[model samples]
Target: MTGNAFTAVIDDTMTAPNIGEPEEDMFRLARHLGLDIQGFHTFGDAAEFPQLQREAWDAARTALDRGLPVFAKELDLGNETSLIYAYDADGYYTHSWHGGKGHEGSDAVIPWTELGRNYCPCSSCRARASSGDRPSDGVYTGDPGYGGFVSLHWASAAEPSDARRALGAALDFALSFSRRGAYGWGGRTFYSGPAAYGKWIGLLRSNAIQSFYMGYFIDLFHESRLYAYRFLLEASEHFDGRPGDELRTAAEHYGVIAKNFQSLNKLFPWMQPHAPIDDPDRRREAVELLTGIRQLEEEGWGLLERLLTWVR
Candidate 1:
């Protein structure tokens, strides 16, 4: 029989889109994990909330009954994804990044009514019900690749023009949000790219940002720099002679930036937006670290520009 609940490790990349839209990464992760996604659904307004709640409840119960967990979004929390693992007469048990009450990774109770009020339509998954067998453990362990190295390999094998185009696309993606402005989906504003970084830096300098948001930015840029380093490394392999040497040097610089981001993340251990950073000394230290990071990123942009001239 299915137990009271099931919980699995949530991949941060799956829940947080450090780059691109959240759902883009979510769907990519689901597919990479071989999940048979039943697609996402939404419910709004008080009248529709009850009906949607019933549908969601039934969906959660059905999946849990079969020993599978469901993905839920917008649970009065940061629009991040949460896993619904079990349900009973009163409410559902969930695990999320902010698992309510500073209890990330632990089960948190949410009354059905409360869930209904804050719920947005989300994807649900199941095992091989047709075969009456549970899904493979590998389902939860699918490889997402080593920093997109697979794409790098494919780009390398293509023509030089093709590789140049790929690099151009990568550069465009890197600079997508360097300037500040409102960006979002369906008219809901969400900070993104360099703008997101700028906003966080502004808040941090003013001592108005929470520790959680600080941690979030640290994780975001850490991952971003890591990916940038990997892409540059792979791009370096495609060139030859002087150009190749230059690319390798640029890759090395990005690697340093990536390591710096890792160090920055260590400064803030918690991941709560409302968690305070009241010490003036600590705030100054954070500002200095961010300034250094921005400087390194500017250097990276300059290096990339030089590389593009050679490739084009």
Candidate 2:
């Protein structure tokens, strides 16, 4: 029940930065929730590949041996985060989306040397992923240097993650993140906060929607706002009187936000990212939903900013 919903992020392409980038915000969410994140993330330069593998190997081994779970990004099937549960001499064992696809559990060990390899080694996975609409599928050219790895483990909170305290911080984040042109993307080709909505809408109206990533945006936003609605409802009950009332009202805003995305998801009908949306009516409807969401979120920012002053 951490307040990460406050950190929802979207980019110009409608993918890549969802909830995971803007790294400092994630650290903020973890901090207020009283947890410490351990491990490292690195781009695999050829010279650093061996060191990256060794570091990840050591960390994963330590965590897994203690019966604690280990997690990694893109362990198999590009863009699919997975669990690093156990290990053996050959490599680290994993249970990710691939296991269900016939790889089976620990048997699908990713050799330690390939720890951060971006693409899949399997011919079928490579073939399908490369040809599919999934932009996350990086080509595994068998070069360790070209890969990237995100290895993570959790440690006990350094301080108390009081929900009451975190609420104030969350509301503060919601207000700040909503302001247009406030956060910088370091010259990267991306957008954040309310400006992101405008970028997304402008693309759709111009019939320039990248169908796969557009579907990705809708789906991710839909799920995040649903959680925001639920988290606020839960957080409301944790406090009393005006603070609680404000939170409940905040929940209502997110509830509407969630429903907005729900409508957008449907209007882009059939929910299949691979399928192109050719119907002009559906496109117009999607634009309306996005515009409505932008307005609704503006209201939410106001409500949350007010709540921020009194949360503690």
Evaluated at residue 253, the lDDT of candidate 1 is 88
What is the per-residue lDDT of model 2 for residues 189-246, given as tens digits with 9 covering 90 to 100? 5555677788888878877765677777788888888999998898888889999899
C-alpha lDDT of candidate 2 relative to the true structure: 0.66
Q: Model 2 Cα displacement at 73 (Å)?
A: 0.5
The prediction achieving the highest TM-score against the true structure is 2
The digit string of per-residue lDDT tens for model 1 on 90-189 reads: 7777665533443333454567655423322221112232444322111112121211000000000112235655455445433443432345442234
Give the runs in model 1 whose Cα sits over 4 Å from its true position.
1-162, 179-194, 270-274
TM-score of each prediction = 0.51, 0.83
For each candidate, what is the lDDT? 0.52, 0.66
Cα lDDT for residue 269, candidate 1: 59
